[model samples]
Target chain A: MNVFLQELRSQRRSTLIWSLSLAAFGSLYLLLFGAIRNDISAFEDVLKNFPPVAQAALGFVIGTLKTVSGFYAFAFTYIVLCGAIQAANLGVGAIGREIGGSTADFLLTKPRARWSILAQKALAVLVLLVATNVVLLAVTIPVAAAQGPDFDAGLFVLLSATMFFVQVIFASLGLLYGVAAKKVKSVVAVSLPGVFAFYIVGLLGAVVGEDAIRYFTPFKYFDIGYILKNAAYETGFCLVAVAVVVVAVGASFAVFAKKDVQAL
Target chain B: MNVFWRELRANRKSLIWWCVGMVLMIYAGMAKYAAYATSGTSIADLMKQMPASLSAALGFAGLDVMKASGFYGMLYLYLLLMVAIHAALLGANILAKEERDHTSEFLMVKPASRSRIVTAKLAAAFVNVTVLNLVSLGLSFAVVEQYAAGENMTDEILLLMGAMFIVQLVFLFLGSAIAAVGKRPRSAASLATTVMLVTYVVSIVVDINKNLGFLRYLTPFKYFAAAPVLDRMGYEPVFVVLSALIIVASVVVTYLAYDRRDLKL
Candidate 1:
């Protein structure tokens, strides 16, 4: 319990920074929608000229370009990218700090079991990611509502909720990398490429119009267009996402428990 | 000189990984182009479907995707991103690792001046970026011949490579400057990554909306946009000079700050 609280307390500042930044980022996009709402038709016409591949790559849907909700969804793609990076950073850094800071020995010397420590760290990360989502929703929801009373409040909530799901996936992946890699010199080094590679894969899947490829990248787990139309996630992809998090996090705990801590 | 060699050796493995990663990415993207070219998917049909705003935002404004140069122009977006991240990571890691790994005191006591140490480290990083760029370019030339479409794309390819090199240098220096200016030397690579992401987002935002056109001057990604480079077969003199100025200013700042700042160790 002390380990959990300490880890949580230590992470508070960064969690706050990431949450505030994400809120500000989402708010900025929502604010931009106001400027664009009046000129949506003009914007749609402009968007209509885009190549299908390009549109797919950017997650832009012409059908949704005219509505504030549609525009928000478009902007939300990039926001999710940012949030994924934040979560990946947190996930990697959680275990990475112990290894990179050469404090794994110090941590291991405690009376608690390694599984307990891992659980506490994982809990800290989950709490922080949850808090981040709450702050993001707090800022985005009211601003989205202000756009117009007709804004689909339920759909907007559903769309925003995907960010948490995506974060969990990336966070688990990060934890795997943290435990699996021989040494992580920088958390950004590990997470940036991981996040971008998956993102690019998602973009390429869009360009290729390949449904199978979509299942491979977490960035495509929740399609805003599908969600807006069906008002729900693709059950298969959601299950795949949950499976990934569970397997990866489970493997990380197993590997980290037995892994030898290198003396600095 | 020993510092330079040490930096080079330390970065050797990652350099090879980056080179291999970039080569594979280019190969994969170009292979897709081959499919796009031979497939019945009409280039014009695809172009007509794309909106002007999206095309411009993606740096796809002027190129005809059917042509090799145009295709390369489109691929340049991904290449630029890969190279920028590589260069920035190299620059940040080279400078910040001493403090990060708690080896600052050992290095500080060496028979070398801080300025010389900084120069050697920066030089080593520059060399790594240069090697990665050259290898990728070589691999691209070899792969591009397989699907050249009979157009002379050599000049445009060279120009684009030059622009990428400049972009890499800009980010490299920017990363160094960030490391130099940071007080505690914590996660300089993360800082560099964030800066790159912000600039990239700004570049895309500016391209998507004409109202934000003024922001084009801020991001290094826009400094050598692919369309303009392909059309002109060269970069704009203003952006080129501006990039040079920024690089020079960043290097200068890195030197001054690194020389004066107290090492945490």
Candidate 2:
């Protein structure tokens, strides 16, 4: 409990900064949706004329620009990317930095079990991620509502909820990398590549129009367009997301338990 | 001299990885272009039916995707982004790792002056950035030729690569300057990445709303946008001057900051 509390307290500043930035970014983009809302035909024409490669270049996938959910979906893609980065940073720094800096001697020597310590750390990250999603919704909802009269409240909330799942997936993946590497010189080194690689893979998958390719990258796990149309997630990808989290977190625990901690 | 070689040797593996990634990116992108050319399907209609929410706005204006250079111009956006990222991370990592890994004491005790050391590190990073650029250029020319159906895209590719080079230099120095001046050496790489990504997002936002055109000056991504530059077939004079100023200013800052700072060691 102390470990959980300690970890949470330590992470408060960054967590606040990240969540606020995500909210602010989304709100700012959502506010601009008003300009596009006034001209549905013109905007639809612009989208029709725009090339897919150019859209992928700008990281601007997710369409239906004429509708509120449509525009929100466009902004939501980048939001998810940022959320992934935040989760990756937290996860890698939590485990990798502690062990790499040789501070694990102080941590692992405690009377508490290793699993307990890892659980507390993981729990803290999860709780903070939940807080990020809440802040994101709280700030963006009113802004989104102001722009479109037909704002689907339930749909908005459901879309916002997937951010938590994405964060969980990235955080778990980061934890896996945290323990798997022999020595982590920089957390950013591992986390940036890991997160961006998945993102690029998703972009490439979209370009090639490959459905099976989506299975390989977590960033593509949720089809925002499908969600907006069907009002639900694809069960197969959802299950895949769940399996990823379980296997990643499970392997982290197993490798971390018996692993040698090199003395500094 | 020794520091330069050592930096190169240390980064060799990662450099190889980056090179391989670039080669694969070019090959994959060109392969898709080839498929589209031969498949006889309309891409715009194809995009709409596959998933509307997958992509909407934020695109280059006035390029026929059917043309070979047009497709390469689109691919250039991602290439510029990837190369710029490599430059920034390399710049910061080279400078910060000394203090970060607690080797500042050893490095500082050398007979070489701080400015000389900074020069060496920056030079090593410059080499890394250039090598990546040339590797990208080579693959791009070959791949475009194979798929371009006899269209000569070499001149346009060369121009785009030149613009990309300036971006790489600007970001490399900006990153090194941040590391040189920042109190938290550990955060330098993340900070640089954040700055890079924010500018990229801002560039797209500008695309979404032309009212934000003024903000173009603030982002390097817009400085040499593939569509405009390819159409004009020349670098924008103002952006070229701006890039030069930034590169020079950042180099000055790197020297001054690293010289005066107290090593965390």
Top candidate on TM-score is 2
Off by over 4 Å in 2: A42-63, A206-209, B35-58
Native-structure RMSD, model 2: 4.2
- Per-residue lDDT of A148-225 in model 2, one digit per residue for the tens? 588888888888888889999999999888988887888887887778778777657535667977988888888887
Q: List the residue pairs that clash in candidate 1.
A: A49-B50, A49-B51, A50-B49, A50-B50, A50-B51, A51-B50
Cα RMSD (Å) per model?
3.9, 4.2
TM-score of each: 0.87, 0.91
lDDT of 1 at A85: 91
Q: Which regions of candidate 1 are displaced past 4 Å?
A: A31-60, A148-150, A203-212, B31-68, B144-148
Q: Write the per-residue lDDT of candidate 1 for residues B3-121, one digit (tens) a residue.
A: 99999999899888788778767776777787667644444555555556544533466668767677877888889988999888888878999998899899999999999999999
Name the top DockQ candidate: 2
Residue B17 of model 1: what lDDT? 77
Give me the overall lDDT of model 1.
Answer: 0.82
Judge the docking of candidate 2 as incorrect, acceptable, medium or high: acceptable
